[model samples]
Every structure is written in structure tokens, then in C-alpha cells.
Target: MAYEGKGVWCVGEVRHGDLSPSLFELITAGRIIADARSETLTAVLIGKGVAAKADEVAARGADKILVLEHDALDQLVDEAHTGALTAAAGTEKPRTLLFSASVYGRSVAPRVAVALGGAVASDASALTVTDGKLTLERSAFGSAVISTVAVNAADGPEVVTTAPMAFERSGTSETKAEVTQAAVDPASWTQNTEFVSFSADESKEIDLGGAEKIVSGGRGLGNADNFSLIRDLAKSLGAAVGASRAVVDSGWIPYKHQVGLTGRQVRPRLYVACGISGQIQHLAGMKSSDVIVAINTDADCPMMKLATYSVKGDLTQIIPAIVSEIDKVRGSSNGS
Candidate 1:
């Protein structure tokens, strides 16, 4: 649609005292769209004390930065965030808005859209400006089907939230963006929610989304006690531990370790699947991994077929042998 307003706006997110990893991803995606639409790219940061973070967004490639801060916005209470975003949109008059597909983005996009009388595209994996229209590709039916939708300029301002890891994060740029302090009065907005406190995930493992390497186990591990094999291998490889849905539901592992359509989506440089059958749901979450290694006795399994390297064997023996080999390699390097 004709943003006839000004630039493409990227709504960035801050979580746990720092900018979320997805913020740079938004900038990378938003820059391309802004260029295609012949508009500037602006990053919007709304949070108390977020004004000091504008430089980070600028370093990531935003041509301009808009900061909206208030005591009420110290955390992402929907009422304050939605109100601040809507107010920013009015001031910026951007033709398009992009947000990270996090808890923050998914919640705020629709509310902001309704407030602006605009159409919203949620959890879109890709964004493109074509033939004077904005198009978004989104996954549907538990990620079994991909559907595309386009919005014309006349349909009102475009609002969108991007799926995580859909676009690669941008590297730091040499250019700096001009920061604009956008005015927002959160006191006037209706307050229906309160942020009591931030609870951190107690899991000691590296977060699946950001892990460089992952070793995921499945039901073939036999019992919860046997999961030690998986843990040993993961420890040797210095990788995060993940599990298929079956093991997670069987009480062999916690829900946080589950990796599937219903669980967290991960993109790691190397993903090792032990005993996993590579069901469609599981594949949806990890097929994007740079390299996949599957170990299973059933050579005909889907995981084996999709794996970059397949090992057909007993998991107990295979995992121990792998770990021992790793120890040998490290020991040799240490000259002990």
C-alpha cells in the first residue's frame, strides 16, 4: 500500500536489560523493505530507560531511531506498549510496521493495528514489497502449509510481526542513525495490566534458539535414567540438550528441552538427532539447521532420510563411543 506517509518503521524489542537478538533481524528485514519502497528505515524502541539503547539500533542499520519511554513502560504491559506504539505511528506516519514475533510482538501488533484501523500480518516468515503492494508469507496449519497475503497501500498502514530467525541478523554498520525522542503519554492510556516481576527460566542449559550446536534425543533412549547418555554426549560436545516431543511427554525430560512444532524453534550450525524419527512437526522446528546428523537403528526413518549424515546403530553404544572419541581428541590436544 502507499505508505504515502514517510518511512518503514521497525518496532524493536528489549528484554532482560538488553536488546533482544531479534531486533537486529528486524532491522535487516526492514531495511530491505524500505529500500524496495523507496523509503527510509526507522527503528522504534519503547521502554523505560530504552533511550540509551538507541545507539545499538542505529549500529544495526536503522537510518533513524524513535525512542518512547515512560515509567509505566519499564516492562511490556500490553496497555502501555500498544498505546505507545499507536502514538508513535501517528507521529511517524510510516507506511509499514515490523515487529519481532516474540511474546511482545504477537501481542502488540494486533492491538496497534486495531488502534490504527490497519491490517495486520502476524508471524510472517518473509516480507516483500512488490508492484506497490506489501506481501507476507506466513506458516499455517501447525506449519504444514505456507500462505501468502498482500496488502495494498490503499488498505491503510501495514502492520507486521516477523517469525523468529526468519531473517538473519544484520552485522554492525558504519553509519549512525539520527535519534528522535517520540512523545508518548502513557498515563492517559487505560491500564489493565501490571508487571509484577521478571522470572528467569531456571534451566541451566544454553537457550535453544541461540545455541550453536545441539544434541537432541528421542524415545529410543528407553527410560529417564538412560537420558544420561544424551547428557554425556551433549556435555562432551559443549552443546545444548534437546528432546523430541515423545520423550518430553513421557516424563523423561522437561518441556523446555522439547523441540518440535509445539516447542521452541531452533536454528543451530549443527543439530544431532538421536533416535528421533523426524516427524513433520519435529522437522518443522529444526530442518533449517545448517547440518543435521541422525543416529537410529531404523534406517528407513524420516530423520535418517533427512539427515546430512545418518548412523544406523544402537544409541547406547553409539553415544558412548562418540563421547569417548571426543574425550580422546581433547586429551591428545592437552598433552596429558
Candidate 2:
């Protein structure tokens, strides 16, 4: 195939040897943008065994999968991957480039854009492509405001890394697509990093990144010991544990478990806030959830006002009761 301007190019990612679902989700959203601009959606699949990965890329409605396979490209050496992807961008010259706002993508996408002398919009919640220009929306300034950015670089394609939980996959396997293989090389690079074995926290092995249900607590939980109620409720509901700014600041919870402007953003199917007063900064991260349930003794709190389901009661009394009810239900079901 000739080097031509296509619709959009997404640098596909694989975590722990599996393709990230966020890639497919972006492709689903990209298709609509590309169609609106009358173009085809192409994807760059980089890593070992690129050919084997092409089938799934095609299945996900990618019009073209540019496969770059080489041992040097096995693990992301930032330098090599950036060079290879920048070369692919030159060859494909896509109108737009999409990437996940994942740690890996966030690290590399900006580098690639810089190498190409292109502008980038990082952590976008929504994207629109029209007349070869892209508009991206993202939360900004401690989530107190939303900013819409437009990128029209004279040098290269518009690059975008989407925020977590902004879009979902839409296309089926029937979408027409074709796959092609390509090779890219780096000019020069130095590899000095040594691989080291590190273990995950057994307690937090279940990541909250893509959780479907989330329950959070705030300073209203009273003290560090009282935070256990939040964890118990989350476990009973098979949900992830989160904390508000006040809770995190009070050292009741770690910063990683925090959900707010400076912390993680979650758009779960169900969000339950216990003892949290919905500050604007805190609400920015989770207000987009499909269902919001707030439990607070203060019935007039901001969170209670915004909650789809509000329960005016003491969390100390409510949480144990909920746990007991769940235990009883499970016990009865198991004939215990």
C-alpha cells in the first residue's frame, strides 16, 4: 500500500501480554470520528509476534494494522518505541493519533509527539475530529473546570491520549478492515536499565483502574480505624475502595486510593459515597458514574444533594448492618 493519509492511527498497547481493551474502545470511538471526516482507521501494533496480534486488531474494526515486529521492540525501551512509532507515523501520516492515558502511553505518546514536532492533548475525556482538526476535552485545575483543547499542528497528525472511562467500544467484528506489516529502526539508543523483580501488594492486587463498582469514604468516617467500614462495605459489594481528599490528607488512607482532582478518576457503573461531603474537587472525579449512592448523617450535604440515592444515617450503624445482611443472604443461599 502507498503511503497515504488515513483516518486515525492509534498506538495499540498490551499489558502483561494481552492487548488493552482501551485500544478497542478508542478504535470504536475513532471510527465515528474518521467516518465524519471521510477517512479510514489504521492502527500501529508494535512488539514481538506482530503478525499474531493482527487478527484481533482486525476483529476490533481496525482498517489497517501496521505490524512492527523485532526483538529490540519487545519491551518498550522508550527510545526505540518512540523512534519506531514516529517512523510509522511518517509512513502512515494519519490525520489523528490516539493513545490511552495509561502510564505507558502517557510516558511515550508525548515523546513521540515531541520527536515529530507535533502538538499533543493528553488525558482527554472526549475527542472530535472535523476538517482535519481535533478537539479534546479534559478536566483541569484540580478538576474545578473542564478545558477543551484544539490541536492543529503544521508538522504532524493530531495526537490524543484519552482519560480513563471516557468512552466505550461500539463496533462489532463485521467492520471492514485490512492488515499490513511494516518495519522501523531507531537511529541510536543506549539501554542501561536492569530488570528487577518486584511484587504487587497482595492486598491491592485487584486494581481500581477499571472497576465496575466503587465505594469511597471521607473525613466524616471519623478516624483511621473507622475507615475499615469503607473497606468492608466495598468488599461486600465486590467494589473498589476509594477515599476523598480530606481522608487522604488526614492520613487515614493512602494517596493512591484517593479519588478526586489530584487522584484517580473513576466512572464506575455504581458509586457509593459513605460519610463523604461532595466537594467540587472530589465530585469532578466520580460524578460521571452511572449510579451514585450517598450515605451521610448530614442529610443536607453536597454529596447527598447530588446522590441518586441518599440515605440519611450514621455510617457506623449502616455499614455493619449492610455487612450482616449480606452475610445472612450468602449463608441462606449456601444452606449454612
Candidate 3:
């Protein structure tokens, strides 16, 4: 298969006036495909005031950097991002475009693909280039199986949105990259969407993706009110709250708190599962945690088997006790 055009592009995301941590993971993924095809790797930073961060991306070994800046990009407007990316891709003509399967990426990848007459695959897990053919792997049926798909470069470029944490960020050498600023005029960019007031969940001020510790709940919690036990335990340990898909689907919590194959992939230092049966789908997301504690009545559940410490009992009874013990330790330290 003759690869079309040249270079592999990673569409990076920015947050809080700097680059997002997920950009490093995309770099790791892009590098693999770039090395396999013996092509140069470029990182595209598109946002307001993201020029300063291009140097850091270049330092991380990107061969080139394209910074598309516009005032309209101050917030994540799908049309504005889609237009900026489409213009950038039109000029650079990268064969493969990679994006993190995040809120921003999910909205932009397909739109860019449509504008460029390319193929797109979302929620992609693994990537491999075989004989210059780019192949992306997507999990099927709750991650119980994986499907491999090859994109035909002859038709157009391949635009891919990868699952967060699906690719690990490894160490990279400091290398310089040629940075180019593409000022996409606002007039050219489309904007049918209006900016609304942004309301954040105060309870989730601690980001689940970056949280060191997480306490997750499942349907076994019995009712939505029981989720407070999970929240209390998480608060006691100064950890973020997570939930299984079953509970999130049941409206016990928001989708942002879901940790599973089809949800957020997290690698916390400590992961405590309460009243969770630990399906394979749930394990697929947090199995990489350094420590796993499973609390369930049935000790033979998959989560219990995978946990570093398994407690066979009722989580309603167990969670409060753990929280109480932590409180006692904290109190003793405070008194000391």
C-alpha cells in the first residue's frame, strides 16, 4: 500500500492556557505510526494563545508544529475548531491525523475528516501500521473483544480519535521542531453555536483522569442515595469519585464519573471499588492502578480476584468503617 502524501499529524488539546496532559499520550501514539512509516511527526496546536506551548511540543521530539490561533477559539466551538483544522490539514496534507477521544477531539475529528474526504474511527484503542497501511483497533461489546480496521489512504487521509490512556506516554528526547503559525481568520471559520455559561461540577473539582486515588461505586450500592457512601469514602481518603457504567446509566451519577471500557480510562495509585461486581468492562479501565481494593459480598467476583486486597462483606458496612478508620488516623495526627 502506497501511503498518500506525507507526515503524521497529532491534533493536540489545550486547557487552562497550557497544553493538556493527554497531548503527550497522543505524541506517543503518533510516534509509533510515524516510525513505522518512516515519516516525520507533526503536532497541531489549535486554540487561543497556544503559541507559547509549541516549543514544549517540539522539545518532546515532534518534527514540526503547526499553531492555529484565533480569538474565536477561546472556547471550544465545534465549527471554529473544525474549520481551523480543516484549513490546516488542507495546506499540510498529512496522511494520518490523530486526536484524543475527548470532548474536544470527539467533536472535531469527524468534521475534519468530512472536510478532507478522509476516514475516521472514534474510540480507537490500539494503532499499528502494517506495510504502510494504518490500522486502528476499537473495542467491541464492552471491550470483551477488539476489532481491527485498516484505512485506505488512496481515498483520503485517515483521521483517528483514540481513547484516553489507551496509549501510554513514554520518555522522549529533547528535539527542536520547526514551528509555523497559521492565523485562521474568524470570518472564514463557521460559528452557528453560541457560547453558554459554563457550569462545572463542584464535587468533581478534582479531575478523575489525573486523580491519584479514586473510590468507585456500582449498581450493588442498591440505590442512588447509597452512592453517598462511595462519595464519603472518597472524601475521607481525599480521592476522586468514580462509578461503574451500570450506575451512571441508571442516572445515579454523571457520565464523567464512569470508569470502564466505554468510559474514562484511569490509572490511579489507589482504586477502591465498593459494591462493584467488577465486570471485565470495568476492569479494562482501571486494571493498571497500582493498588486495587474490592469490597463486595461475593468474594468470587472478577473485581475481587483482580484486587490487591479483597474484602468479602457488605460495602455499606465496609465503606463507613474504612472512612471511620481514616478519620481516626487523621485525628490522631492532628492531635499530635
Candidate 4:
């Protein structure tokens, strides 16, 4: 395997005012691949005056910073951003393209790959490079087994979208590298959608990823009212609250808090499931958790079978008792 002159490019993510956290996370992970291949890790920051953010990326171990500065790129319109990224990728000719599996990255990676005549693996849990080939591991069959795939592409870069929580952030020394600025014309872009407004909830929400403790409730929570107990327990433990697909579909909780095959995939340190049946689909989303605790009435439930700890009882009574215990612990911590 004659492997030389390989470049790894990570798509820079930006929100309204500053760089996104996930972009840093990706850079941290991309550095590993870059070091493994003995190649440079470049970051593409696309937006007007985005070049100024190169210093921040440099702090995160980017060897080269490619800034696509354009007035039209100021706003993250999928079409414009994708076009600019595709154009930049064409010019750079990286061997591998890494992107965060975020809202923006999900929208852009596939389109850019298509434009570059490359192959894309989305939402991959693991990525490895060997012998000049990239192998992507992704969950399949309701998250029971992962299918490892080697993307075969004859031209352009191989695109890979990594789950936000798939890999821990790389701890590498920063490298001061050259910054290249490319301004793409928006008129040349094929715009199918227009930006209407960017008004969204500005409040910071708890990120399920990287959460040290998580408390999730399933359909067995009984009613929407019973979720309060779960919430109480989560608040006491300073943990994020999650719900199974059934509970979300039943409108017991918002879809954002759902954890299942079709919902947000989580890899928390401690996952506490109350009343969740532990279906394979549900299991797929959380099986990677470091520790699992199930509180269900049925002893034979699939989740209880795989749990590190199980408590069989009525959740209506059990959840409240757990919440009380957590509250007591918090009170002691606060000198109450």
C-alpha cells in the first residue's frame, strides 16, 4: 500500500455568532486519523469572515485551516454551504472528509459527497484507516449489530459522518498551520431554499451526549403525570432526562428527549431506565452506555435481562422513592 500525500479535512461548524462545540469535538477526533496517516488535518470554515476563527481551530490541533469566506456563506443555507464545501473539497482533494453528525453536518455531508463523486457513510460510530483505505462502523438491524463497511471510491475524498458521542475528544497539542481563504460566489449556487428566519430557542439545553448520568422513562411510567417522578430523580442527580420511543410517541415527553433507534443515540456513563421494556430498537440507542440500571415491574423484560442492576417493583411507588433518595443526597450536599 503506497500511502502518501493523504489529507484529512473536517467540516467546520458555526452557529449564529461563534463556532459550534461539535466542530471542536470533530477536530479532536480527526486529529487521531491525521496522525495515524501521517497527514495534515485541515479544517474548512465556511462563512463570511470565518477566517478569523482559524486561531480557535488552531488551538484544537488543526494543521491547516481552509476558510471559505463569502458574503452569501454568512448564513448556513444548505444549498450555498454545500456548494461552497463541495467546491473547496474539490480544490483541496483530501483523502478523507470528517464531519460531525450535527444538524448542519447531516444536511451537508451527503450533498457534498454527491457533488464530489465520492462515497459517504453517515452517523458512523467508529472509523478506522488502514492500508490507505477507510473503514466505517455503523449500527444496523435496530442497533443490535454493527455493520463494518469499507467505502470504495475512485475519485475525490471518502466522506464519513461521526456520531457526536461516538469518540472522545482528542487531546493533542495545537499546531500553528497556514490558513487558506477561498471566497465562493453565491450567484453560482443553485438555491432551492431561502432563509426565512433564524429565530430559535436561545436557551441552553442539556446535551444528552457526554452526560455523566441519565434517567430515562419508558411506557411503563404509566401516564404523563408519572414523568414528574423521573424528572425529580434526574434533577436530584443532576442528570439529563430521557424517554423511550413508546413514551415519546404516546406524548408523555417531547421527541427531543426520546432515546431509541429512531431517536437520539446516547452513550452516557450511567443510564437509569424506569419502566422501559428494553426492546431491541430501544436497546440499540443505549446499549453502549457504561452502566445500565433497569426499574421495571416485569422481571423477564429484555432490559432487566441485560441490566447491571435491576429492581422489580411498581414504578409509581419506586420512582418516587428513588427521587426521595436522590433529594436526600442533594440536601446533604447542600447542607440542608
Candidate 5:
């Protein structure tokens, strides 16, 4: 397939004046695809006063950086951001454009694709350049199945939004990319949407999407009150609390903590499942975790089979003991 664009591009995201951590992961994935196609890995950074952070993106893996700056971009107005990104894409004409599968990315990427008359794939878990064709792997049917799709290169540039924790974050490099400032006229673009005040989630705990360690509860937890055990264990380990779909559907916990195909997909370093039967939907969200520990009474549960460590017991008793042991370990370390 003959490609229309010159190189691979990653759309960088910023939060609180810092580059989004997901940018590095996208860069890491982009590097592989760029190298395979013998093209440069470029990144588009858009935000007011973000020029200073251009080096950060370069250190990760970008071979070049396009910095789009404007006071309007300081706060994320979807129309302004999408317009700027669309302009950058028009100028760069990249063969493949990557966006993080985040709330910001999901809202912006599709609009950019529409403006460029290009194809887009959302929630892509894997990417590859096969025989010069860009093939993306995404979860479908509630993550019970993996679907491999090849984009039509002849159409135009291919835009894709990658799932969270889909790829490892790229390491830093001594080499810095050449940064260029893109000219964008915010006034020229028609924006019906206005930027309003932003309010964050009320929960102070770690969000499930980016947590390194997660302690999750399931239907086997018996009732909503038993979630205390999950929280206690999470607090002891300094981990986030997560929940299976059944638990959330049953109103034992809020949907924010739910982890499954229908909920948030997480790839934590360590995932501890208490009383989870390991339904297929649940496994789809967390099977990518580095280590899985399952505590369940049933030994034949799917989660037990997939877990790196399996403990057979009652979670009410098991979780408290684990939390106690963790506290003792922490206390001893602190005392020393």
C-alpha cells in the first residue's frame, strides 16, 4: 500500500502545565511503528506556555515536535484544540496519527479525523505495520474478543486512539528533537462550544486507569459493607480500590471503581482481586496487569487460573490479615 503521508505523529496531551504521562506511552508505540516504516516519530504539543516542555516529549521518543501555542489553548476548549490539531495534521500530513484513549483524546481525535477526511480507530490496544499496512488490534464484544483491522492507506492519514496502559512508557533519550512552532489563528476557527470552569472528580484516591496497584472487590464480597475490607487492604498497600462489574451493577460500589470490559480497563503493576469469580469481562480489563493475585473460595474460578498467586479462603478474614501484615511490615521499616 502506498502511504500518503511522510511520517508517524503522536498528539501530546497536557494537564496542569505538565505533559500527560500517556504521551510517553503513545510515543513508545509510535517509535516502533515509525521505525518499522523508516519514518520519523513526531509529536504535536498544543497548550499555552507549553514550549518549555517540548524537550520532555523529545526525551521520550519524538524525533520532532510541533508546538502549537495560544492563550485560548491554556484551558482545553474542545473546538479550539481540535482546530489546532487539525491544522497541524494538515501541515504535517502524517501517515499515522496517534492519540491517547483518554477523555480528552476521545473527544478530539474524531473531530480531527473528520476535518482531514481520514479514517479513525478508537480504543486500539495494539498497533503494527504489516506489509506496509497499518493494522490495529482493538477489543470488541465487551473485550471478549480481539479484532484486528487494517486501515485503508489510500484514503488518507490514519488516526487512532490507543487504550490506556496499552503500551509501556518509553524511556528518555539524550537526543532532543527539533521543535517548531506552528502558526494557528484561534479566531479564524468557528467554535460553538465555550470553555467553562473545570471540576475534578471528588474522590481523592488514585484513579483506576493509572494505578500501579489495585485492590478490587467482586460479587463474592457478599455485600456493600464488605467493601470496607477492600478499602482497608488498599489503604495498607497504598493502592487504589477497584470493583468488578457485578459489584457495581449490584450497587455495592460506584461505577468509577468498576474494572471490566464495560468499565475501565487497567494494567496495573499488581492487581489483587478479593472474592472475584473472574468473569470474562472482568479479566479483559485487567489481564494485562503485571501480576494478578486472586483470593476466592472456589479454586476453579477463572480469576484463580489467571492469577499469579491464588489464595483460597474467605475474603473477610483474608483481607484483614493481609492488611495487618502490611501494616506490621510498614511499621517495622519505619522503626528501622
Candidate 6:
């Protein structure tokens, strides 16, 4: 079987007429695969007025930028975006396709894969090309185990959705690629679905998914009112606030702050678990963090076992001390 399209392609996500941060990360990952295979790294941008953002993707290591602009794609209707992507894939026939593991990418990638007769790997934390075969590593069994899946190049293009923060954004390239406009007829494609208005849920000041540092509370915080300590520590650290399912269930925090298998998956650079017992369910969501610090009264708790640093004490006493120390350090630094 002969493959027509000869490179790795990334499906970029655009929001508010700009490229999403995850798109840069995907470009980095795609560059790796493209380099391994000695192929071009292309990015497919689908949205109205998205052509202007092609230089951003090109600078971030996209060798070729394919723009699929349409009025229907402006608001991200699953069907419309999927149709445009499917059309692009059929024309390009890239060796591998990459998407962000965001809500939009997760929703559209699988559909495009099915339409193009390809296999899809979702929520991949790591991607590589070994012996010219694409491999994806992702959490499985409620994130208790990591499973690696390999896609054969002999098969069509491999579709992959990468988890946020799994890879750093690619550095700017001195060389740039010219953006090409791809033709996509929305009318020819079945318009079974129509996009309506979108309403964002009440979100935290910091987005948990993309947060580099997080300070999470749990049932061990003792009460809803005591959660202020968690908030204070998070604020001091300039980190997002997270909560275990137990805390959310107990109404100590909103569901948006919940971090677990049933909640949002986070891959922060630093994770501070205060008053959390470190249940497997909660660990499932954050075990991918680069560094974990656990403060719990029980030394034998699971969080302590998994943490890089474990502080054994009462959180109420420990957290305040941490805050004071941070403030003192900042004050001294500012005074100087």
C-alpha cells in the first residue's frame, strides 16, 4: 500500500481567533515524530480567520500549515469541525495526526479517525516513534496503570490526542513555512448537527488542567470553612486549588476543583496535597505530576508513599507556617 500524504499533521485548536497553547505542545510532539520519520510537520487549522495564526504554528516547528477556514467552524460545532478535518485528512493523508487532549480535540479527533479509516489513541501522555512505528502511552485502568499502544505505518495515518502539559512547547524555528488554504465545502457535507450558543461553566481563577503548581485539599481539611487554609496556601504559592473527590462530595469545594478519576486529570509541575489521604482515585488524576509534596497527619497514607516529600503534622499548623515562611521570604526579598 502506498501512502499519499508523506508527513505528520497536527490538528490545531483555535480559541478567540488565536491558537490554543496546547497547539504548540502538539506541534512539539509532532516535530519529534516527523524528525524520527524524516517527514514534514504540518498543522491543520480549522476556523474562520484562522489563516492569520499560521505563522505562530510555523514558528513553533510546523513545516507546513494547512488552513481550513469556514464560517461554520467559528464556534466549534463537533460535526462541522469533524467534517472539515475529515476532508483535510482525505486530501493530505498524513502519516500521523495529532490533536490536543482538550474537550474539543477529544470530541473531534475520534470522529475524524473513524471517517478516515484510522485507529485513534486518546489522552496519550507520551508519544514516540520507534523503528518508524508510532507509539502512544496513556493511563489505563482508572490511571492505575499505563498502557502503550503502537500504530503501524502500513495502516493509514495514526490519530493521537495528547494530554495537556505532557510535552513542552516547541521553540521558535528560524525557518518558516508558507500557509496553504485547503478547500472544505460545508454544504456538501451532511449538516446533521447545528452549533448553538456556548456557555462556559463558572471556572476557577486558575485553570487546573494547565496549572504548573497546584495545592489541593481533601476531607482531611476537616471542614468547609477550613478550606480557606488550602486557598491561602495556594495563593501564597501562586498555584491553582484542587480537591479530592471526598472534599467535593462533602461540599467543601465546588465540583470544578475536584481532582480524581471521576474528575479532571491534571499534570502539574508541582502538586502539594494538604490534608489529603491520597486515595488511589485521587492519585489517578495527578500521579503524572513532576513533583508531589504531601502533608498529612498519617505517615502511612498513600499520598505520603507516593509523594516526593512528605510532611507529617497537622495541616492547620503546618500550612500557616508555610504561608508565613513564604511571606517572610518575599518580604525580605522585596526589602532588599
| CA lDDT of each prediction against the hidden true structure | 0.84, 0.79, 0.84, 0.81, 0.87, 0.86
lDDT of 3 at 150: 82
Between prediction 5 and prediction 6, the one with superior TM-score is 6
Instruction: Please write out the lDDT profile of model 5 over residues 85-196, one tens digit for every residue.
Output: 8887777789888999888888988888888888999888888887777888998776668999988856568889998888889888888889999898887678998777
Q: Regarding lDDT, does 1 or 4 come out ahead?
A: 1
- Please, what are the lDDT tens digits per residue for candidate 2 over residues 61-179? 77777787767777766777777788777766776788888777787889888877777888887877667567878877766678989876776667788876677764567765677
RMSD of each: 2.7, 3.7, 3.9, 3.3, 2.5, 2.0
Error of 1 at 133 (Å): 1.2
Q: Model 4 over residues 34-83: C-alpha lDDT tens digits?
A: 88788888888888777778877766677888888887887879999988
| TM-score per model over all chains | 0.89, 0.84, 0.82, 0.86, 0.90, 0.92
Best by TM-score: 6
Can you list the residue pairs that collide in candidate 2?
Answer: none
Clashes of 1: 3
TM-score of 4: 0.86
Model 4 regions lying over 4 Å from their true place = 1-5, 48-56, 172-180, 202-204, 207-213, 320-336
Put down candidate 1 lDDT per residue, 49-135, tens digits, no spaces.
999898667778888998888877888899899998888787768888888777788899889888877888887778877776788
Which candidate order results from sorting by TM-score in descending order? 6, 5, 1, 4, 2, 3
Separately for all candidates shown, the number of backbone clashes (residues 3 or more apart, or on different chains) is 3, 0, 0, 0, 0, 0
Error of 4 at 287 (Å): 1.5
Predicted structure 3: lDDT: 0.84
By lDDT, highest first, what's the ranking? Answer: 5, 6, 1, 3, 4, 2
Is 4 or 6 the stronger prediction by lDDT? 6
